[model samples]
Target chain A: MPRVPADSQTSAGFDSNLLAFTRELRAEGVAAGTAELLDAAAAIGHVQWSDRAAVHGALSATLAKSPEDLRIFEVVFERFFFRKAEETALQRGEEVAGKDPGGEQAQRIDLEALKQQIATALQEGGEGSLRDMARLAVAAFGQTQGGSGVVGVDVQRIRRSLGLRSEPQPDLPPEDARAEGVPRDRLREFEREVRRELERQTIERTRSLPPARPLGDLQRGLPTGQAADLAEIHKVVAQLRRKLATSGQLLKGQRQSSAIDVRRTVRASLQTGGVPVVLHQRPKRPKRPEIFVLCDVSTSVTSASIFFLAVLHALHDSFRKMRSFVFIERISEVTELFDRERDFKKISRAITSDAGVADVSGYTDYGRVWLEFLKLIESELHPRATVIVLGDARTNGRPAREDLFGQIAARAGRTFWLNPEPKLYWNYGDSVIDSYSEYCTTFECWTAAQLGDFVDALANPRHLPPSK
Target chain B: MSNTPKTAEELASRLTADGYLADTQTALVAWLAIKLGKPVLVEGPAGVGKTELAKSLSRVLDRDLIRLQCYEGLDEAKALYEWNYRKQLLRIQAESADSGWDKVQDDIFGEEFLLERPLLEAITSEEPVVLLVDEIDKTDQEFEAMLLELLSDFQVSIPELGTMTSRSHPVVLLTSNNSRELTEALKRRCLYLWIDYPEAEHELAIIRLKTPDLPAAVASRLIELVAEIRGLDLKKPPSIAESIDWARALLLLGADDIDAKVFRETMSVIVKHRSDLDTVAERVGVKLDGGDAASAS
Candidate 1:
């Protein structure tokens, strides 16, 4: 037999590992197609195999299509390529040794000393030491002694015990922070490092996790309406809008009625010696659905309302007419704010602070707000209009305006109610979802993915539920 | 100039010589684009040097740069090619009625009357050129679809004339602000690279390179302040371009360190928005003022 190449074994291993990694990425929603996979494989051949950063750059640029995909690609690449077998074996050895009573007592870490080391690391502002300290903290405090034969990592508990919750202590004076030569932001960075290590440990412990959107998993506990979250939502909305536009499901009827463009026709006639033999027509504009959004801007449902407004703002180009209203106890038309400000942050701020929507207490009053909304937009309501109501349906035990909601549903061609709370939490406390949900279709839109599905359905009128 | 970079590291150094400090990812993607004869789709926030990357690549490759600035109604006539309509009309009027239609068509449709746009020029050029399609996200989907033939096959099709393929392969770069999602078809034809805000050390090096006269200490300090400001959740973060400007401004002012008073004067060099200025002055201003107090004590 002919002699094989020197690095044949390693190269074969790398190829198989890369193929598995690409499949893992696809299962985790990275959108890596065959083209990207081939590009990644070809790219790896060009870079030096020993140079880790170069290899990472090549694979990342070839495989990851978007910034979101890049993030998932990085995490998977790290876990797959650098599993640290030695560390795992070492940890397993420790676990086996600590099974005995005497060894278990010896393995116990001093909480006070660990806390002191973290404080010193924070004050010194050395990233290397801080990261080492985070790993130590995770090793000592992150393990959960479950009653069942299972080991789990709890980063939140470690954060609390180390007094590094990513949120600065409100009572700590700025002067003290300056004196310590380390700001609260530095501590926050250290805490993030700890969280990352804990996540890695969890992944190692489980050996496999259910395929999930990495973004959804990371931002599970994050409060909504953050700028980054808004950006992510904006991207997803843009994708949905593109899909709806490309499908042409909504533009079928409108194509036949397109008016001829006179200017283009005249211009085209010049090429033919001024005789208008061939007529040039304008591209038919789609028949756009009219939209009216009545959003609850009360403190309880502020997050959901912000997201709704953002989604509608992104989809404004696909609609013929649109209007927005923000309400706490009364309705105030704030469509001008959207028209005036291109920045979402400014629009959100104006809606919450200076839009002058709240006429009474801060509590949500659905009955009065719905009555006022009907009075405001009753004349403008038409058969082609789609009315969307965004809120938690938490009326604070106020009178439910079932009749007013029914009138809205009757006047508008379609009515959709998007509640930010989960289905289980719908009728638990002061929520009156049942009172008004009968008049319109209701969707639980607590996450961006749910909002995407709701908008996708809204774009296709045939999928809309019948209004009662 | 005739020598292309043999490796990503070489391409990165060549780009640095042209005053662009590209990270490993950017350099690798660009090198692959050259080696594979594909385009690079650069996406990021505004003011992050998406356009500058094209200019730098053109300079590094020693090729003429042809730019197509896309907007809301950008069409084939503006970006690809356009007929000299007025000239065509004049020629038609000048032609005698006795002359046959074939003669007039042959004369007018020749290269003399065909007005080549940036895209057509990049393709038909005798020498290779760098084609930059800037802010492609602003164009409508139909225009993007029109570009698919040109981008994938390096050819343009005209109804008046047959398809024209490029003899010299031009390096192509398309930059988008990501205002909207581009079609997947366009993305599939190019290598993707996202150039985010540079890290502190990387940005410091950029400042040092761009403004050599600025003191190293002052440049590092300015970059530190910029990083801290970016840490805050502002509507618009100061980009690397703004950071370099601020460093030059500080050098021109002959400032040793960034104190609160000095910062207030030169703050506009970095922060542009009215709201951002207020926030930066409050958050970063306190740190500088606190520093002043401690030194004085």
Candidate 2:
């Protein structure tokens, strides 16, 4: 649990409300785990409670880690924090009792009867009637974002089984609720209340019915550094890719060549009475940066390094030169392996279980890996190239060849060190950060936010200055 | 005058005086960070002035702005503190050959050879310090982890020299361009602030402030046009810095307003990517040259 700030003097009622709201968010499939909820509570303890934006902004910084999570969080936040539902209800002095208690709300549409009626319509040669009903059924209930290969949406299943439609659109908020001029927060509040009502009714109406997957589940994944399995990690990385792809920042090198250069077009056409005929672009694209990634696939950094590599592969278009190296003891170039295998599981398996990267000791050597990888890339290393070395930096009693790192720092535009271990362990035993600290900036990147921010910087280096 | 801001509004006003127009949220966050003495993690896209805020804070508060520029391979020697190894080695060598190792230990690791990097300097400074950890996401994870200790408690523990604490706590502002996600532990240690591209009006104020000689008509048109270009699905969006550059570029080219020819010639200033320039030019051509043709079509 997050330790509440000592200065906090919030009412007990506010704390309970915060917890209940967290539960609602969790029910909506935002993996806003225990730690995050505690952080949220602590966050609320500060600032004037009357300040809506401050509360929202602080909670947002703590809770929303991804775009989809941000979306769901915004909805849940409106429903919980900014909500006037129960307040207005009590203020009106209206006895809104029962809320149609028991099986009343959930059984409004009987699935068994609806299925039977659709079957009958299909048998009666009124195919259009079945189509209309299916459309209506899907619109009323849930839908799927096709190609996920999960079971069809509950409403779409009866129709798809009858060979009506092959694909369904992604489940989004209702039309009236999604419409503009309604202030999205209010709509989100309405949507959540409606969904919560449906959920309560469904549980009451049919006690034995299996619950449908929440619409927001597709966007949620295992938090960074908590992926214990390989296949699951792949799925999370894929989700991360989708999130990044939808972001406004474009990975510049790909699909950028389509637009013609107009300034050059007008300049060269001055001889032809301002009628531009032949274009005069440089005929070359802007210089793309070379990124050399040296990953420490030591036992400690394996899981995180895989995630780092997966994200790098997902954003492949962002770099002109992308090279990857993995080192446990001896350094080996794994860029070809990553390019060849789209499946991270296959790549991870082949590299870790198959390849003999580990020396006889199965240990990490910061000294030899630094010296050896530099030797490999020294000739080809450009002053503009940015080399990223991801590892825990535990030298394991081997001499930390600090000079080679310094030498690489001299060769490349910049060198950065990413240690998966917490900073507390940076100097513990074999972790020799003092030796390598002189070369480049190091950061604690045990979270997805850090990795995402790193990729964002890589994709948009134009705004940054040349070198430190 | 109170060197420590008494209110968020005061800080905001002072920041504006320093030529940084922080919004209510940014002002509030900065105020809280200052009052609480916690590091403020300022995050946003590039050119949103995350670094500028720290600089402005230093100027406004009348403190030394200590900057630690982060990149890959940045380690303690560069970031936190570096022992003058050559001096230490020379000192040890110059000492009596028969002297014990413990005899010269205090002499080598003392304050003289202790070269304080940004982090150590900020922590150990006698006066007020504003530490700007710029582009923190560009550095490695190890560097990120190292910041956690310094950020959490304004102190550092050295093996040779023992623990060093600050006389006056520095106002630490760590900025990231969303290059990488900083960990929860790190975020939890500080207040968070994110800055987006300013709306038209604020940007206009900035443009006028930057280029005092530019015509008001041209500046408004330029802001409107840049906002439109940003709306387009271009590779690299034009940032405020680019907008200022474009304003300057227009003034140099002697264009009062963004006519087609002037816009076409000066498009490169605002648009970094060739593709965006092409798109902007075509749009201009349609709006300016194909006015009747577009209407007829």
Candidate 3:
């Protein structure tokens, strides 16, 4: 007989494991269906079983639908394969018991003190470290299924201590006997009671505690765009820049250079008789594309606009030239200020620093802004340049001049509108996004994630980046 | 060639013979695709050597490399199979001049008038062929549908002929730069492999294989500079093919070391974008000129 399970050692083991893992993945909102799972299973035959990276690659190829799915698969794969039951068992063995043996008969396991430790950890450590400690607390005192801190084992000792059943259950304490001899079950009861009490107290404490400042993934779920903290916006810009814009020299790879210089190569071949010893290639890089940024700095979408400009400013090396304009009721150029400033901290102030360009505060008339700009600087706009507009598209019932926007879009290479408001508000109220979206590639970007998608699309405009 | 490594350990060895190296996963996938008679869909960003894998497979397999380079508006007539209409017209004229038009007209739609494209050519070839449908994402959805059918059946249907099946069906490989999202139906039909930029050690192996004559220090410096540039924000990034080309360019210049002067003169070899060149000159140039170590961050 094999020491491990029959399925674990064989290729059949991997197949079942893959199926079960895909099921978990589907439960987690990844759209991995039956056919995808089967494809993933088939892929395992080609890759080395011992090589987890190879297995990951094979599964990612079969299971993942897009680059987003691939990222999810990486996380799911670690949760499924790397964090298995055996490792969890080893971890359980390593966990220290919470009971103090020095005190006579362990002094009924301090529930209040345990709750205090948890509250302090929750306050001091981040969510990641807190979750780890919570899992450890559960493991050491409470009975849990395994390593994953998601669910704890049924609170058997707690139910026993409280005496939930009216009659004496088999192998359980007699209902009346709890009135006499409840002392025998106290050690086990101590473990279970502390976990339950700690959990309840921890929840109450965290609710009273202020929300963490540097928003973790816990706070990333909401679609709060402009409302996000300034530091969070900086984090988002740096992240999006890395993921979407920063093109690596060793990444976007090579192409077959067109039309080898045969005359030059052949002439050089004369050094080794008629055979071409060396081939010469005159490879040329493709011409850089231009981006024209038009930002609206009204009071409403100021934060979003600042981040948009900050990210674009930071990524100026990617394009040939990026001419920036800030508009309130009229437009004016701020390229010189951005050209001088590389620090993002300084950029936030510099964007809204000059009150003159932003028309010195008034009702945001977008039509007037477009009319004023088109009349003065239409010559600067080129067919090869993409104009990106950052606004909420709330025109305050002013004349939107959608046709003027359309004409500008027609003359330029391409047009994109990034509205800071959630897409649910696109056609609602005074949002003229409905009228404007028809003329350009318009989308809602209320968060860094959305902005990342937008930036990715801008970098490679051949296709829209699919939602992660 | 006779002594080519047959096992997994030898896969790297065998592929290295051509100055191209494959990681264990890619090697395993290639071996499996050949053994299992399944099409392998390779997808990645541009310049990661997706097409080079096909060439390497063709070389390793000792088969004719049939490539159907995909583009927009690529229809079945160009991709899979098309009838030889011109040849048919000539034959019709010749047959009518000699025999009656009745027999010639019936035979005009036969296999004699059939013109086999890459897919059909690979299917009908006696020896196993390595069929490369390069840049499938560039083509439209209709071409993908045709590929789905052809890939699944391993044969093509013709009105003139019933169906031509091969005794030895070709090993199919489809590559995409992921410019456009391919349909799920197409991805499900094949084994998948994504080729990324190799790690430092993996890339060094490839560099050594491609430019065997280069000094070790120079190779290290070239890779080091590329890694540094990769960290910078730029428009178009250099790929593996570019690294090889850059290495070749440096060798031609006969530069003994990577210093400010050599890098200043030949910076364009690696940096393709004008803006990126400017950034590199400003960032990397200052370090090199400061009389600091060449490998300064």
Q: Which is the leading candidate under lDDT?
A: 1
TM-score of chain A of 1: 0.54
The Cα error of candidate 3 at residue A192, in Å, is 31
Query: Which DockQ values do the candidates obtain, in the order shown?
Result: 0.35, 0.05, 0.13
Show the colliding residue pairs in model 1.
none
Tens-digit lDDT string for candidate 2 (B101-122) = 8878878889899998888999
Ranking by DockQ: 1, 3, 2
Compute each candidate's TM-score over C-alphas: 0.64, 0.52, 0.54
lDDT of 2 by residue, A265-308 (tens): 89878989899998765454444568888887775564466666
Please provide, for model 3 over B1-297, each residue's C-alpha lDDT reduced to its tens digit, 9 standing for 90 to 100: 342235544665677676568887677667656745678888876777888888987887677899999999998888778889899889887778778777887788787788888888889888778899999999999889888767877978776678788757787899998878898888777777788777666887788888778888989888878866765555666777778888888888887788887787788887888877887887676666535435543
Question: For model 1, how does the per-residue alpha-carbon lDDT over B20-52 read when each residue is reduced to its tens digit?
Answer: 999988998899888777788899878878899
Instruction: Give the residue spans of candidate 3 off by over 4 A.
Output: A1-13, A28-31, A46-51, A86-446, A449-468, B1-9, B97-102, B290-297
Worst 10 residues of 2 chain B by lDDT: B288-297
**Residue A380 displacement (Å), model 2:** 50
Q: What is the C-alpha lDDT of each candidate?
A: 0.77, 0.68, 0.67
Model 2 spans > 4 angstroms off: A1-10, A23-46, A65-69, A82-88, A91-468, B93-100, B252-254, B289-297
The DockQ value obtained for model 2 is 0.05
